[model samples]
Target: MGKIFTVLLVIVGFVYAKPEIVIEDPWVRAVPPTAKNTALFMVIKNVGDDPDTLIGVKTDISKMVSIHKTVNQNGVMKMVHVDKLTIPPNSKVELKPGGFHIMIMGLKRGLKIGENVKFTLIFEKSGRIILEAPVKMK
Candidate 1:
């Protein structure tokens, strides 16, 4: 009876020891066909007790997909590449314009409004999350 109880406790603990990540309101900026770059915005929510880190992003529409943050450098606004983005336990992170965003560079084609683009978000704890973001002119 003692061994069975111990095993059950361990199993329960393992089940709860993970990050629950949710992506919400994912969208990409709609740009003209001549445009070569665009951005993606979304809200990332971590509802679990464990924290998670967004390490990478993948998409076929662009040659490079990366995490970036807009910053004011010497009174000039610039987008800087970020290595990773962390979402704390039970908290949320917003990726919006002039803030933390996913930069899609060297686009093969322009993003049309009302169209969806598939993206694979790689997280440290939660692994890869596949989702589609619609193109909008927000």
Candidate 2:
């Protein structure tokens, strides 16, 4: 009976397990009026034991929002679309310039500095996280 009880406890714990995600320093890049695209940068930290994957992003500022990564191909830098970005348990992933970032394309208007933009980040395990990121330069 003791063994069975222990197994039940383990099962219960597994059922309740979830990823604790924290977003820090989230900001959108300021763009000119003629610019049609921009990017969002932030630090994604997972404090829980379970890992989570960032699968998609939704924003009203643009119709096209997707994950992208900067890569060097034959000594030339380029940005490539990525389907997902995984954040490991107890670790943090920094989305900065020249690295992983969220590409906001088809901008409806220029993103001015100090303007806040709402974004819904979809995670595989953590679900949708809504945040307002301020627009900044660099």
TM-score leader: 2
TM-score of each: 0.88, 0.91
Give the local distance difference test score of model 2.
0.94
List the global CA lDDT of all models: 0.95, 0.94
Highest lDDT: give the candidate number.
1
- Candidate 1, residues 86-105, lDDT tens digits: the string is 99989999999999999999
Local lDDT at 30 for model 2: 90
Q: How do the residues 34-107 of candidate 2 rate in per-residue lDDT, one tens digit apiece?
A: 99999999999999988999999999998799999998899999999899999998999999989999999999
**Clash-forming residue pairs, model 1:** none
